[model samples]
Target: MTLYETIFTRRSVRQYDQVQLEASVLAEIRQAIDNEKQLPGQNARFEIVNADRLKGVAAPHAILAYSAGTDAALANIGYTLQGVDLHLQNSGYGSLWMGMGKPIEQSADYRILLAFGKTSAPLRAGQGDFKRKSATEISNEDNAIARVARLAPSAVNFQPWKLDFSPGKVVVRPDGGGIRKLLTGNLQKIDLGIILKCVELALEREGKAVTALTPKGGGKTFAVEVAFE
Candidate 1:
């Protein structure tokens, strides 16, 4: 399946089968991470933890633990990780981002985890199941991208975000009213990355394209300038 198809078809999987990952599958994942690290402006490092070691460390079944060299490094981390997430989904692996809290450690760097494995059974969660505000609710009637932005995920399913459309841009801002400050720190940034994945995929499926700008300054708000080529 295509990446966009996987976005619509994928659902969060919380359970997994006992089978171990295939050698080829493991290689592909490692290769993808390696390639992403070589991309320009990327400083994040990804390490594949052994499932047994993970269990020993009280980690999830299969994890890609990522850490950035600095705070400014997170934007590149966000973009690259989203690509990794979508690639895994398209390859038929069940994956979810774990962002509630980081495990206590001596390390001072920022960390995010991606868990992957085969689903033990059919996914119990519904795909595209969340209720989204109508186009009129979030933007002008002609704003088609708002429909896709509504599909983005937030911490604990809060969906705390709003979109504003102008002549050629779509602004994404978080609604702090619904977000719990401590429970999710910097997670919303990762969630925004996921939303960007959905919007890009959805727009491409419709034969549309847009330029995504790197988020500037820290706050709940960010913008993606979408213009026709």
Candidate 2:
């Protein structure tokens, strides 16, 4: 399956049978993880754990845990993790971003988990039918990329970023209010990067080309512009 198809078809799977990932598939995943760790601006690392190792942990059937040392690192980890997830889905495997606090001993200061396995059953009715907010709902201006960004996953599905579009520039800010408090700091920003990557992937699939500029400012509250050549 193509990466675009995987993006559209992938969904969170929580159950699995007694099955082991094929050696080739496991190798591909390991290679991808290695490449992601080498990517600049992120200190993310991943490990594949056997079912026995996950017995008492809050992890999924087979777990791949990604970790970093800081909030900034965590954000980068999220982006890289999603990219790997999309790639895995395209390769005919299913994956879900497992939530944190699943009971695990960790030396790293920051961490996230993803569970992988074949879908126990076919896609049920409305399995991939989740809806995203309209452009106007998420941003006032027309941001094709930000629209895709809105589809990025978050901890418990809590999307907590707001975009302000200016000519050749898109400003991003935290929308931490009531329930949004659940998503804060690096997790929120990292999730934003993941969504941005998805938007970029989707746009590329449609044959539209865009150049993403570095986020403006130094910290929190930045901008990413999608410039069409």
Candidate 3:
């Protein structure tokens, strides 16, 4: 399946068949990580490690996703690794993002771990299988990009992004206020990264030239504006 197709059909898998991937497959996964695009100004790293090296998950293999620990690092980690998550599903493997899994002191640099292996959990049959917010709920206009962004996974499914679209650009910012803001502020950035990734993929599929993302005007929360070239 194509990566774009996997975007709609992939599901986060928890139970995995306890078999290690072949060396060639593992090498390909590592190479894919090496080629993943980076969000500007964010430094992220990834390494394949034994599942036992992580404290809270069971899988034949786990990837230690690490970053420079900058303010945008967590969100960037989400942006970077979401591609791998899609790729694994496209490759017929199952993957789950473990936000709470502890890396067994292999390094303090680890930010998140992804557990992946074989599994019998069925691939989601279609886009309809996704239980996500509607496009209207996440954006000003209910367009194709917004439809895809609405399906982006977030911490507890908070889906904390509000999008504004223009003729040649897209601007994304945080959504929610009051207690929800206080509770999900930091996590919302990571959620935005995931949404940004969805937008990028959707735009690319539409033959739009995605430019480098730049920061928007001043606000306590982070915002990004992406222009189509």
Best by lDDT: 3
What is the C-alpha lDDT profile of model 3 across 12-32, one tens digit per residue?
A: 898988888899999999998
Model 2, position 34, has a per-residue lDDT of 70
lDDT of 1 by residue, 90-159 (tens): 6767776666424444356646767677764443243446555555665553455566556555567655
Once fitted onto the true fold, the runs of candidate 3 whose alpha carbons sit more than 4 angstroms away are 176-185, 216-219
How many clashes show up per model? Answer: 0, 1, 0
Per-model RMSD to reference: 3.8, 3.5, 2.0
**Superposition error at 94 for model 1 (Å):** 1.4
Worst 10 residues of 3 by lDDT: 213-222
What does candidate 3 score on TM?
0.91
Q: Highest TM-score, which number?
A: 3
Give candidate 1's TM-score: 0.76
Choose 1 or 2, whichever is better by TM-score: 2
> Which residue pairs does candidate 2 place in steric collision?
75-190
Better of 1 and 3 by TM-score: 3
lDDT of each: 0.56, 0.59, 0.80
Q: Write the residue-wise lDDT of candidate 2 on 68-150 in tens digits.
A: 54444555666678877877666766677765534245554436567777666443243246566655666766566665667
Runs with alpha carbons beyond 4 Å of true place in candidate 2: 35-40, 55-71, 101-103, 123-128, 183-186, 206-228
